[model samples]
Structure formats: C-alpha cells, structure tokens
Target: MSKRCLSSAMLKFAIAIMTLILLISFSFISSGAYAQEKISILIPEDPTFHDLDSYLDIPVVMVNNTDINVGGFDFLIQYDTGAVELLDVNLGPVDHCNWALIGHRPEIPGVEKIYAASGPNPLGCDFSYSTDTLFYLQFHIKPDTANECLTFPLRFYWVQCADGHVINTVGDSVYISDSVYDPYIGDFIQQDDTFPTIHGLPDSCANIPGGNKIKLVDFYNGVINVACIDEIDDIGDINLNGIPYEIADYVLFQSYYIYGPDIFNIDLQMQLGATDCNKDSTYPTVRDLIFMYRVIIGDISPYPKLGDDGNELIQPTALFVQDTLAQEVHLVFPDSLSAIHLIFEGEIVPDYSGPEGIAYNYDGIVTRLLLNPGFSGTDSAVYQGLFFTYTGDGIIDSADVSDWEMRDIASEVGVIGELICGDANSDGLVNISDAVYIANYVFIGGNPPFPLESGNVNCDGAVNISDAVWIINYVFIGGNDPCDADGDGIPDC
Candidate 1:
C-alpha cells in the first residue's frame, strides 16, 4: 500500500482503457467505408437542336455509384410545356428490371412519372449495374415556342436498395436549344420571340406531271425528291374492278377499243390500263383482248398474273396416292402451301391410329417444321399430308380422289384429277376381300395392303376387326357397298 505501487497500477489501467477505445474506433471506420455507396440520375450536358414538330428523344440515365444491387426506383421528369410537347415515354433496357410502370399527367402538362422495379419479388432485384438508361422521353418541339433553350430536370423521388433500405440520390438536368437550321435559307437561326415554322417541299416538286398523285421516292434529308408515276397493271381487268380478268372485263375492253371512251359509262382510260394484259407498258389492243380470252379458257394467265392484293395466284397441283402399308390416303402437293383446306367428295378414311396421327413430313429442299405456335418459319414453300375422310358412305372408290378440290395459300381454288383412293390392295375394287386383308394385317400381322386406303374398309383409318365386320355386313346384310356408294368410276373420299 505504498505511494509508488498506487501510481503504477493507475497508469496501467489508463493505458489498457485507451487501447480498447482505439480498437473500437478502427472497427467503426471499416464498417462505414463498406457502406459508403450512392445512386444518382445523370443527364447529358450537350444541348440538342429542337426541330419544330420533329421528335426529340431525351434519355434519362440511372447511375449506381456503388457496387450494391438496386431494387427499384421512382423518378419524376419535369419539362417546359411551352417549349416542347410530350409525345410518349418508353422504358429502356435495365438489366434484370422487367417490370415498369409509367404515368403522364396531362393536367400537369410537363411532368412525367416513372416507377420501375426488378423481379423475383420479396427478394426484389438481384442485379448490380454501374449505369443504364432508365427511360426515354419522346418530345415534339412546340410550333409556337419562343424560348431558345428548354430544360428537362430529373428528380429521384424514391430509390430502394436490394436490402429494402431507402436510398438518397442526386439528379441532373438536360438542355435543348431552339436554334435550328432553316433548310430553305440554308442557315442556322435562333428561334426567339417568334413561332417556329416547318419547312415544306421544294418548288420543283410542286410542278411534277402527276400533280399530287405522284409517289415520292428516295426522300432523304429533305433534299432529294424523285416523283414516280403510279401505274396499275392488272391484266384482263378491263372494267378496272379489283378482281381477276373475266369474260365481262374482256367484253368491256373490246367494246372500249372498237368504239371510243363514249361507248361505255366507265372511265375508258383506266380500263385501258387494266386491260393491258400483255404488260407491254402500252395501252390495250386487240392482242390484249386475245390474251384475256386465253386467260378465261386457262390457256394462259394475264401478264404479271397475280391474284387480289398483289399475291401470286396459287394453282395447287396435288398428287393423291395410297400408302398400301399404312392404309392411308395422302394428298401430296408439288409446292409448299400453308393454310390448306381440302374437301373430299366420296367415301374415304378420316382418322389414323398410328403414333404419327396422319404421318406427314415436309420432304423437299427445305424440310423444317416450326413447333412454336404462331411462328411462320422461313420454309413456307412445300407442305404435304392431307388425309381424306369418308363423307357419304364408308365405301371409298376412285371417284373420291378424283372429285376433290383444294385451296392454296393464296386462297385460290384448284381442281385435282386422275387421282384414285381406296385401293389399298391396288386391286381396283373395295370389297370383302379388302376387309379380310385389313383384318389379317391388324390381327395376325399379315402383309400390309398397298394404297392403304383400300384396307380401311370402315373408313376409320386403321385396318382391324371393326373393318372386317363392316365388310361382312356390306357383303351379306346389304349394309353398304365399299368404294361403290355413288358408283361413279372414282372414289370421293
């Protein structure tokens, strides 16, 4: 308990307390440094030229100064209503932020509100980015603006971090100048204290031969203007109607040529343009009339032969064949066509029981099927597989295949002929023998029938006991004749 001992103990305690305080201070500084991240809204400093009545795209960019992930943001953009008119607000590509909501208040004419958030809700956005465009403001310069410069100021109303912490952010401003180039005068002038004016086409374009009826081609930078004369070349359509050349149109063309424009109540000049079937780029003549007659008789098509709406006419040429082994009638097309609709007139099988419902494949130079719904793939030229079903009686014959029609992609109807169905055995007749063959194949795994349609006695697609019973009923009980209902030389299935 001496004085020297008391002094030494007090000094040691003081030193120990100071060491602990310094360690705590160091820990606090380290934690603060790790949390020091910021977010901001950046506006470009460059001034854009404001062209009257022209669109100006102003980009609002978001800057994440920290490496921390951002969850969501709410922004407010204020513009000068008198200087520019807001047309549209579009969202930009903010990675991982898939949901966005935008609102414009017309009552507060110049203000736009935007709220965007990232996905996988609850956990919110799981992405980190340095900079990205938040949205675009499409504005049109007002025709009556007097200000030389328009300013758009951005304000971050609310910003949230991935951890659900509200963040404070800084925003910037964008400037657009009203001083623009006057194309007529070829000079830049400041728009001040006066309404803006839009430049019109040059005086030379005003005196074009076709007046305002000419089409403007290659129009760029408001300088080069080429006027093209519009001409209609619908061969055989002498009446100027929006249909294919027909007999009525032929008569009109002939009468107009023999007599004069006064011979008909229709516009003779327009009729001449339509009747120029040869497309020789000249007026209609006797040769054009002859061409129209040929088109009617299917000898030839009108020059530049096209159906309505400039689409090429589809004359579907189908080859109907019987798959003896499968016992299915396939209607094959030479070219690829889509949206095909076909009608079979006689008895034929409709459904197939195989794994391949109807066993169809696009086998040609391009053979790719698009599995996606609503997807029109590049291979649209060759399409196949149209199965026939019994319409009248279950009896399929040659007439069924011969008396069928198909509509091509262009909706043009075409007739098919010389094709036969219901000859699965290829024996030329559908009867009890055909039914027995089908049953043997289905039950005992006998030889498959050729031109498969013949084996489908019941026209139910598969050769089975049901088809055998159908044949027995038809042969003995007079139920129905197989492939001979109408008795026309062809099967109508």
Candidate 2:
C-alpha cells in the first residue's frame, strides 16, 4: 500500500524467521516424542464448597515431573451438565503459553466436553511446565433440591474432535483453530479461521499427535461435593422432630459434642441445639443434655409452661444448680447402686410419688435412704443414689441429677453401646431394630441414629433410609460389616 517494494534484507529476515520457527518446532518434535510417566492433568481433589446458583472457580493443574518438554498443549474437560455449568476458562499465572485456543465441540454426540489448546508463540518454551497450574475454570452450580450431600466430578477426556479440528470429539460449540503468519502483512494473522490440531488430543485420544506432546499418567479428575444441610429454627429440635426432646435429638446432641463445630458445618439444624438449648444465652452444655433427657422421659416440656390453673408457669428443674455440672456429674456415681435419689421437681405441688420409690419431692426432701438425712456437699456414694430416674425437669431433685443422667449409659458425648458405626439403636447390636430406628427417625421423626455417628451405614456421612436399607442387606443378606474403613470411629474388620 505504501508504493514501496520489499527490500532484499526484509525478505531475507522473513525467510530466517520462518526457518527458525520450523527448526524450533522440529526440535520440540524430538523432545516431546516419547510420553513421560510423570505427566498428569490434575484437578483439585479437595471439595469445592460452592453456593447454590453461584459460581465456583477451580484450578486445572498439570504436574509434568519428567524430562518431556513441550511448547504446546491441548485437552478436553468434561463435567456433569445437570450439576454444574462451565462458565469460562483462563490461562494460569505461570508462563504456560502466550495464547490459547478454546472452544466447545458441541457437535459431539454424548456428554459435553471443552477443547482447549495453547502455543506457537515464536516466544521461547512457554510450556516445559512441571507442577504448575494450567488453567482456571469457573463453574456455576445448578440449582437442585437435594436434602443431603452429593458429589459431582470434573474430569478430562480423550476426545478425537474428528474433522481435523476436534469438533466431534470436543464439546458443544462452533470450532476455531488454524493460524499462520502472513508474509506480506509482516505479522501473524488467522490463516485458516479454524482451531488447529497442531497440539494433539489428550494422550488418551491419540489418533492425531501434535508437534509437541506430553505423556499423562492418569486422569486425576476432581469433584465439587456439595452439602445441602438445612438449618433448623427450633431449639433442641436437632432431628427436626416437632418437640425438642427425644431420643433422636439426644443422638444428635452426642454428635454435636463429639464432632464439635464440624458437625454444625454439615447440618445447621444443630444451630438451635448448639447456640441455646435452654435459651440461657449460652451454647449447649450438659445442662441441655439433662433438659433433653427430661423432655424425652415426659418429665418437662419446652412448650409454654403453664401450671394446672393455666396461669403460673414453673420450670421443673429449678433445684439443681443449673448449668455447670456435666463433667462433675459424670465423675460422681462410683458404681451402680439400688436406692438412687429420684430428683424430679418441686414446682408441681412440691411433692409427688411413683412406682418402686420413683417420686418427685422437695423442701427437706431427702431422707437418710436418699442422702443420709443431713448430708450435703456430696455423699460418700456420690449423690448417694442408685438406678434413679432424671427423665424429667419432671424428675431430677436437688440431689444432683448429674450422677444419674451423666452416667456412661450416655454421658454428655456418648451412649451405652457404640461399638461400630451402623448401630442405630445403640442397644449393643446392629440389626433390624437399628434399621427400623433410622427409618422411623428419617421418615417419621421417630428416634435419631443412635451413637450419633452410628447410622451412617453407607458411610456417606448422613443417616437416612439408604443406610437403613444397607443395614437390611447386611443383617439378613450377609453384606459388609458396619465398621467404616476410615477408622475415624472404629476398626473396619
């Protein structure tokens, strides 16, 4: 256009540049000819915690720990369409490649996958990469109403894009690749408006080998495991039973104590069970356990506490020094005894009686049989009781309900029999009863998974009907034992 003819030196310079490009390409042809064993395209293994309908960003790493050297690269990424939507792809921070050719090969027949490639930048080895991030992918989690945790994978594929441009083997979009430098224009431009196969497909899709390549050991796919734990608003209603007091609620209480905040991280229903079981402005304590036991045994109620006259409200367990006695009570009770102090409540007419010395009384309540008549500060027998019932804000007396309620039968954290994980009943066995317990608890708000961690028979970390079915399969059907392999709870054998 400038009316000037090309100078000889300029022509020579252009030829030299082209010659150098060919030489560099051929040099890589040898360096990358043999696939190395250490080459691997890795996705993040740790779970990607993403919000529903929200975007999640993850890294695509390539750990090339071998002598293989390559100047270009390409691969296809596949994912579950229903669970996530791939939004965008970006080059990693390292000197991976100067430019990348990315497109969706939607023409493919089956699951969707993305075809991405990089290189040919006259710039020096942009990808002799060893342990580096290759690409960062952003994904949007599709909205679904799963009440429990679920895992979805993001893996690499060996798709042969077919038409020389990888359209059929790639994912869902129009293809773009071939590029070349124009001599007269003196700059690189799109010579063929199509994605080039210069970079071969993922090693597994090896029909067409590119000029530069790397041998990948395996497809280290990653996942985004989403947890859909619902938050319960009611106090002590851990299992979502209408009332806050039940065997199921107690089971969750044990889990909350053992796993701590992590359990809450999985289920927000424990929020009420944790933040304030008694509304005392404090998180759950043994006091809450005692309270839960009272409600379970029909001794107290979390509902509007109205007296018989329907006017005055009386909290049943006012006698025990409220709170601050979980461990102390566990330490009491040297051993099992017969005549235990049956401490219920004095607010109900100050006195009441039940079968076999099971009664609720107050105001000079303890006799010598109960606490040596005048003994205080703890009797020699540790609250000096045996086989007593504190099933109530209705039961516990001023004689320290801790010794009874906090016994190993299920202290603040555990139950009587928690040998393995599938024991939903905790009655020292895993059988139809445990399955029935989980089913009733999961479907009808009956009782929770006993031992808190026991009901996860399937080991997916949440107790549900699937676990009940697994128990059925193991019980009468002779399946794997209940112990999980992780050893976080007990031995697997």
Candidate 3:
C-alpha cells in the first residue's frame, strides 16, 4: 500500500512543476516583444484638450492614412512624435524649369521666399482628412494660361507622410512652362543641384499692370538708349570715354498671385534710339522685368496660441539663410549661457548667443550671427542663433526657459583647413605645389593689365620671390590674412 501511494504522489508533483514552467515562459516572450517595439507618438506636444491661443487647431493623426495615396496625391510628414511619421514626398519629374517666389527673395540657391499668409479670415488653403485611412488634399490652380479654362488638370496632392501630409505630385506633366504660376504646382517642382535664378531686372520694371494679380510681372518700355560723345556713328552712340558700347538699363516686371486662369500677355514695345553724349540726359528706355517665385510647403496658418508653451520655443518667423552665413557660432537656446559651450570651426564664421550676449547689436533679434572676420582667418561668415544649431536633445526644458543661456551652445560641426594662401588658384591652404600657379600668372598670364604687381604679396610686386613671403606669413606667422576682405576674420582669399 505505501509503494503505490508514493508513485502516484511523485507523478502529481511532476505535472504541477511542468504547468508552472509553461506560464513563466509565456510571460517572458510577451515582455520581450513589447521591448522591441519603438516608442512613437503622433504629436510631440500633446494638444489634448487645452485652450489654444490662436484659431489654428492642432491636427489629430488619422491612422488610416498611413501609406495609401488618396487620389493621385503625394504626402509628407511635417512633424512626428516618433512612431507615426511621413514616409516620403514625390516632388515631380526632374526636367521642369523651376521659378522662385514673386516679391519673395531666396536667401539660398534652391530655397525660395516663404510667404506668411496670416490674417483673420480663413486661409486660402486648408487641410482636412479625406478617407478614413488617408489624409488628402488637392490644390487646384485658380485659372491661368496653363489652366486658364480651368481644364489644364493642374493639381498638386498632399498625402500623409508620417503624422502629417507632404506636398507632392501624384502623376507627372500636369502643366508645362519655363516657370509655372501655381504655388501648388510649383510645390511639386523637383529640387535640383542647380538652383533657379531670378529674372534680373531693375526694380522700376517690376511693377507692371497685367496678368494674374498674384503672378509676378515685368514692366518698362523697350527703347534702349545710348550715349554719343562724338558724331553718331553707324553703330549709333559713343560715351565720353570714347568707347562705343551699348548704354542701356534693364528692368524686370512680375505679378504676385495668379488666382485662376487668364491671359498673361507679353508686351515687348521698343522705343526709338536716343543719345546723351555728356551722360546727363534721361530718356525713356526699354526695360524688362523678370519675376521669380518659390513655393513654400508647410501649414501656412499664423494664428497664435495663448499661453502656448510651444510657441515660445519657435521663432515667430522663419528664414532661409545660406551656408556661408550659417556656419559660424553656437546656436543659443533659452537656457542660461553661462554653463556649457559648443565649439565650432570652419571656412564659415561662428554664430553664438546665450546668457553671454546676443549676436547682433541692432535688436535682441537673434537671427543668424555673422562672426567678425576681423578676428578669425577664415573666408566664410558666421551665423549665430539663440537656439540649437539643429534639432536635438537639449539640457534644459526648452518649453519653459524662454531666455537664451550663454554657456549651453555647442559647436557640432567645423570646416577644417579652409585657409587659402597666395596659391592664386583659390584652393584652400598653400603649399609648394602652388609654385606652378605663381609661374603661370607671372610668365604666361596675359591681360589688359597684368595681374597687379602689388598683389604679388612678397612685396617685390613681381609675383615671384615676394609672393612666397606673403604666403608664408599668412599660413605660419599669421600675417594680415589679406584674403579676409570682409574683415570678419576669415581670409577671403
């Protein structure tokens, strides 16, 4: 009786142990899966239910619009909390000739002026959810030559990128022209290595009356004038300098907005010839105005948020500064500037701001800082800000600390060896290899005026023995780095 009872009890214990082990294994697997997933939120700044200061409402993520293109539209994510984000934006084909913004100036090559379309009325364009899973918007041209009949089928699409929709094109070839007038269409223009140029014209020729009120236009009549110092030769006029060259001024005209579609007429009226030998006469001249426009893709809402901590972190406005002017200095954040500092170096100047001081003396406006070339031996200018150079993790609670701190800036990047010497070839840094450059200019170089001898640098002005000395001082002894024509300290060579 004892042997049977012992065997049964042993079997029961084994079964119970196995059941406990299975439960523990399942719990471990579930926990590991959760850890592998990333932490992603739709909005970095939760707008849950709060009193917004402005009319612009924060958008909620419609998870359905994840990857699907609504109609023929492209989407992008403007901002993402982490998990939800825009995938990509399709700008358009590569071949179209792009144009810049009208009246708006591009601070850099590829970037155009972004208009801050703010007011009390409803914005010209508003975004909304389309399908349950797709956030979509179609921008239609009001009507113009390409879409004058409103039948050009010119459309730009905004599709969900990550948490937001990116402005893009669905299909190709909706409109064709040297430069399209529709902002929506232009938004999809491909960004190329080469940037578009503004129609170079005098300001007088910019204000002509024609075309869509929003489109850019050119003004001025076409009658090029010339000066005649001597008798009017067959070629027409000669200046007092005795040089017979065309003496004419050029102008550019453009319109701001082209709402729908209308005739954008090009009137080229040329005036007869006139002469002012002494250079004191003013006559009507043929002027041309070229207008440029750039499409800015973003939420164009400008309503303010009352007691909004988010608003305080961002600058009231946006700017497209060039790298040349953006390289210098540490970006200032709202924290105190006395604690930490960022070190930056490059052909560009350093921009710095914080508790130490503001970059510009004009106003407390902490725009890009231009380092004093008078202090450094670089060619590029400095750009400073009272914010982080780029988006990143910060030490302070950026939302609460509104004033820029002095020590918190960090130089995240630096352009090394940007100094240029008498190399004459304009390459940064000087070495024995530059000797060939010297020989070419001295012996074979031909010109109306030989390369200025004083520029030889070595002081003999002969471009030979003297030039070498100038190079040595600039590179080693720190001679007045002549290249710094701007005196911001960077050698402007």
Candidate 4:
C-alpha cells in the first residue's frame, strides 16, 4: 500500500471514532431530559368557570399536578386598568386565588374607614353597611423561577365562591414540572411588632377525605396602615361628625390554606381616598398604605435576615423600620396650598367595617406631606418637586453613599440627639456634654458607647484625656470645631 492510501485510511478511521463518540453523548443528553419529572397547569373544575354569578360567596380551588410535592404557590389577579392583586398562595382550600373576597358586611379587623380625605363618599361617611359590589374579581399565578425550576405538566385550580356575584377570570395555569425548578419564596425576619392586618379571603377546596384536600390557611399579605384621615361637609348639619368608621374597612382580612409547603414574605398596601361627599371640592386625589408579610408553613428551616445578607449573621439588638417599603409622595405648598386635601391609594384589605376598600379624604388643606420610602410616577407633580429641606450642611447630602444609613446607625448608637443620653451635659455635642460623658465613663460607673464612640468628637475612637482637652479648647479656647454633627441644637463642647 502506498503511503498516501495508508494516510487516507487512518483519517477515515479517526472520523468514524469521533462520530461514534458524538452519537453516544447525544443519547445520554436526551435520556437525562426524559427522566426529569414533568409539570402541568391546573384550573378550576368546569361548571364554575361557565358561570361565577352562582358562586359569588363560594371559594375557588386550584389543582397542582407536579411530580414532586410543591411547598406552596402564588398568583396575581390583574385588573383591567393594569392593577394587579396578589392572591393567597399557601396551597390549601383553593390554590392562591381566594384572597379577593369582598364581604357584604365587615367582619375581619382593622380595615374599616368612615371619612376619607378625598372628595366623593361612596359608602356615606356614616360607616354604615359593608358590601362587596364595589369591585370586580380576577387573578393569575406564575412560577417562582428563582427558587424552583418549573417542569412541564405542573397544574393548579381555582374554585369560585357561591355568593352570586360574578368575577371575570383569565389566563391559563402554565405547566412547568418536567424541569428541575425551585420556588423563590422570599425571606422573613422575626419582627418585634405583630404582623400587619392583611385584608383578603380564604381558600375553598372540596371536602375530600384524604387524597390531597385544600387546607384553609391564614396568610399575612401586608399591611394597610391608615396614617391619617380627614372628613368635611359644607353648608349643612354634619350628622356623622368627622369620619363614620365603616365596618368593611375594620374587619376585612386575608385567609388562605397550606398543605405541601410554606408561604412567606407577604405584603399589602392601604389605598387612601379623598372623595368629596358634598362634591364641592376640585377633582379627588388618591393615596396608599404600604404593607408586607411572610409565610412559614409546616416547618421553618434556617433562612437569612435582612442584614445578615452575606455569610455573616450580623445580630442586631434592634432593627430599624420605615413606615413604607415602596416609594411614596409627599406634598408641600405655600399658605394657599395647605387646604388642598391629599389622599393615599391602593386596594383595601378585607376588614369588618366594610369590604376594607380604599379610604377617600373628604376635605382639608395640604400642609407639609412626607411620602415614606419614595414616590412613584403617578404621584402628584407638585409633591415630586419638593425635596427634603436640610438645614445647615453635612447633616444630609444627596451625594453621600451611606448618609441615611449613618444617621440610622447613630440613632441606634444612642447619639440620637434627643434626651440627655445624646446631649451629654445637655449642651449638645463635644462641649461640656462630651467632657461629662467621658468623665462619667472614666470615674462615674458609666459605660462609654463602644462602637459609637468611633464617631465621637475630636476624631479619637476612645473617650480619653486627650478628647477632654480638645473639648475644652473648642468650647472656651477659641479653637474651631467640626462636632456639630446635627446643627439643630447648641453645641455642648
């Protein structure tokens, strides 16, 4: 055989080997995929879907058909105007869609409202009867893509209530079971305060004996904190006085069912309203209350806290909290603007006074308004222009990275600039207060603020004799000082 022929034969043999290897790899990949569990979408059993008017007061059921038991579930009910309401998710009585029930009367707690700052009064400021006719019902649940992989074939259902009221439902239960997936159930930190009252409904499953029945579970979606309310009437005897306190506003709450997994990190917002009962004021404005919660099913495993984000568990004696999580709007105007009433907007949680709907403000002027967290695009244009006016420099700077965090840390460190604790000698800062605080720690059985002293006057991390000398120089020796951390009060040094 010639050298060229031999070389050609070798090349063909090598090609044959490579082809065999490729075929083997492809077979393994396909087999592995096929072996994975499949998921499917589930929906309410028929008849209920055909007509919801017959089952207004009844519960909706969702069926899950994943191969592995799912811990819990969640879904969203988007309104025609693009408003999305989250349904109860802890898989029980119904899937996660029964959380939209508006009661004919108030029975829950903390959701009732009498007078809103807005213009038109819907239920009359009398706080009379609570009804469910004001709203249209709908919802949808998407998979938590981060925590779990959704495989094909995952299914769930929604059983409508039997109250005679009809709600428009849309969207299909998307199946996601075949692939390896996890649920993105968020985190929950043990808080000092009780969970905020969440207004909603309970899951309604069939009365099956054993084969996977829906469990009526209780869930905290969020809070509807009514920061303030105002009422007004013109040229007439106001019979109800200020606000009447509706039953629906006070009693509406959220309920759910849990079975396979736990639901956590729920949130809610209280809608504020300014309706002119007399219809004498300008067009009404809307407002909102921010709320949130977390669910823990049968058992709670270890989870991360907000501060302990990275590997370390930064245990804190006390955690800081804000009035709202999402951004909000604050209004500030000259004398003429004080009378313009402001309102908060959002969906009403279920409560007793009424269907815990939004609160509308009746009448009033606008003074200084501060929207917690921040504001959104829909907020009043006037409010968006008002910035937090900071008196004196260094106290706050928009460009500072941790300026807000530093203020909070200072408060936690006992230098809150309030009582004697912050005002050492009551003079305020580095002056006599600084000297007094240092003396007391050194000789008067007092403990110096440890980590906090790092931000203390004179740039010394520890309260020592040198700090005392510097305090004296700044207070009496005509030395320039930079210790006015906050320029509100007189410098103690």
Top candidate, metric lDDT = 2
Per-residue error for 463 in candidate 3, Å, reads 32
Ranking 1 against 4 by TM-score, winner: 1
CA deviation > 4 Å runs, candidate 4: 1-214, 218-387, 390-493
Decide which is better by lDDT, 1 or 2. Answer: 2
lDDT of 4 at 21: 41
Lowest lDDT 10-residue stretch of candidate 4: 253-262
**lDDT by residue for model 2 (1-493), tens:** 3334436545544554454344433433332321243455556544443335655567765545444453334456556777777676655443434434544444343234444444344423334434555556777767775613577755544335443231211223222222222222334343222233223332333334432222234345566656443432466676665665567767666555433434555457455444344333345554455556556666665421111211111111211221112211112222332222323333222221323232333334332113211112232233322133232232233332232222212221122422356766544567766776676567434436534577877767778777776666566545566754453545443
**Model 2: lDDT of residue 5:** 41
TM-score of each: 0.24, 0.31, 0.15, 0.16
Deviation (Å) of 278 in candidate 1: 51
- In model 1, the worst 10-residue window by lDDT is 218-227
What tens-digit string does per-residue lDDT give for candidate 3 at 352-454? 3422332321112221222111112232222324242432111111111111111111222212123233534333335432433444334333111112332
Candidate achieving higher lDDT, 2 or 4? 2
Model 4, C-alpha of 21: deviation from truth (Å): 64
Question: 3 or 4, which is superior by TM-score?
Answer: 4
User: lDDT per prediction?
Assistant: 0.40, 0.44, 0.24, 0.23
